[model samples]
Target: MHIPDGFLTTPVWATLDAIAIPAVAWTARRAQSELESPDDRRIPLLGVMGAFVFAAQMINFPVGLGTSGHLVGGTLLAITLGPAAAVVVMTAILILQALIFQDGGLVVLGANVLNMAVVGVLAGYLPYRLAGRGKARSAAIFLGGFCSVAASASLALAELLVSGVPMARQLLWFSAGLFLVSGVIEGAITAAATRAIEGMNPLWIREARPARPVTIAVAVLGAAGLLAAGIAVASSAPDALQALLPGSKNAGIPEGRLTKIVLGLAAMILLYAACVIAGRRIARQRSA
Candidate 1:
């Protein structure tokens, strides 16, 4: 679902970038307020979740018809880390994917973040919250995850149409069809992950409190390790959009096994540090 460069015109991406910058900043502020403490577990959990999402996205599952889909993780992050924190985590993930791995284009990075992090997370989470925790929460999570991917894909398709890309109408319908299958896969994953996390440590998602430094270290390290491992096993299959629209020219770093591990680790570490710093700064600002 990463839109490479040249898919969007300059003006379209620029306008989205303009909107995304402040929106992410606002989310950061809101996350700090909601977490309510500099040492809140959600702060470190953001790092952990970001790493997990980044790694998960690398491993694409076959969705039949020669197309593949990967976990977007936006809805899962929102359910676990709160919507605002999910946005911050996703923004960091998207930026790293663009700058380090070149998985996404720098020009369209803003639009990617806007669609996946801001719109996707919020669209998924708001309804989940409205449904409330119970038997319905699981269903809500599924719906939320499904909607997140569908909404993000819709936005991306709309961007392509508005940008006047060649065969935009055909691409829109094709991509929408692909998302229907992908969204169901995403929904199931989101529901399963939420259930597992809730069973293991409900406080991780529900309460805002300080986590032990060692706990944070272990969580972050575990996620980083999984990211490194996942990169090695990631399928070479093209993602849905790539399968539908080939011949994109966005270049990325060579992905040797060692290079993938190294880059994945580096990206996770950078994300963890950035989220911690951002959380701290927001905490200080809130106190003042």
Candidate 2:
């Protein structure tokens, strides 16, 4: 639910921007602390998880009523990385989506970031932190995914309403129902994905064991395939926010569909390279 420019009032976006800036800075420090470790594995783990979240957000499925839903990946990141690190990954994804794709708007970037990256990740992580290690771990994870999307979507809807997006009360309730359906789907996807990851490397999440290079490669490659397939299969349905703006979607994604796809691919490559470089730097610093 990336809020584009001109959708929000100046006050709404400005207030969120003010709150998001210091909040992100604080989270960055916390992420650094989470990454500070002798294991070295934690370094690459950060970027890999970021890529996972990035790719996950790309593939949207139809959820009916001229709207679509996609995996938000907040809880998954929180489960794999700590809440602080997850926030950092999500923040980077949102920023890149805004810049490279104009998938979101610059002026309102902070509002989107706060909704999806900060509160979304934290809201999802709360349940897991409470009951993840016990037998209720499965339920906790599902709820995490549910809460992640629910919280972000709820905030987006509320903000849009507050900013005078002009939805009838019925439409508002309809949007809420759509969001709830999406949240349930997200919960299921998250739980299944987490289970698959744990099956492959249980210690990766809990103990920070190094993920095999091959596993990461396969996952990234799979995501790439999905991205390609998504372009074809992804519904043309407007998302909840876009639905309100009627006839306002410009050129698939502000620069033609092909251009957006190419940039997305290129951005993924840059993310991988940046991660490798940063991971090496962190590793060296810790070693010395």
Candidate 3:
């Protein structure tokens, strides 16, 4: 779940950010080293895989309790691409959110990135990596997806506790429940997607390397567009945000819903164009 502004206290957010910045930079460097030679053929595939994940996340998984969460795709990506490289791609997605849509606060950027990208990638990849091939790999993917969500939620709750947010005990339970539901959905999605990829392109598991910059850029754009679009769709529906704000009318639909939907479509188009162009270039390169 993308946390909105003002939920976390300034001090707590700031502290989490401080702890997250250097950690992100370090992860980026590690990813670079892990990246295969620039000429490696797997880059294009990885780029496309990232874009596929981005698009997949747009379709929200139905979680009960009137709450739905989008696919985290951390474990799925790690299963397809290596964990270190997945961190790089996931961090890019988070940065896009903080900068473009304002879905998350700039003050909490580092912490958010760490919680969503670093922790998620590691949680998903480590288990699968530890497990050998075959059924173990599948189990790792499921566990990784669940653990990633749990870790991020736990981290968010920890931040709340540190910030002296009122009702830490209550908040902890809420966070646990919310993330547990989200994690189960994510695990199922990850498992199905991973199984499909395994069936269609088992070779993807071996090609965990860096790809062309243009392709990477396009895929990153796609992921960001999909996330924004998903949020826009959610915004159109009944918003818990509005309910939280007292004095807000629960009467008919909100005035801004149409605008959000239109913007989402436009964003989706832009990202599709970018990905198509990048895909073309990649195709040409492959043929050459």
- Each candidate's TM vs. the true structure? 0.65, 0.67, 0.63
lDDT of 3 by residue, 166-245 (tens): 45334545766778877888887888877777788788664322244643453554355335425532363324334333
> Distance (Å) between predicted and true CA of 275, model 3?
42
lDDT, residue 215, candidate 1: 30
Clashing pairs in 3: 43-211
TM-score of 2: 0.67
Compared with the true structure, model 1 gives a TM-score of 0.65
CA deviation > 4 Å runs, candidate 1: 39-42, 58-69, 168-171, 207-288
The C-alpha lDDT values of all candidates are 0.70, 0.72, 0.64
lDDT value, residue 161 of candidate 3: 44
Highest TM-score, which number? 2
Judged by lDDT relative to the true structure, which candidate is superior, 2 or 3?
A: 2
Q: What value of lDDT does candidate 2 attain over all alpha carbons?
A: 0.72
| lDDT top scorer | 2
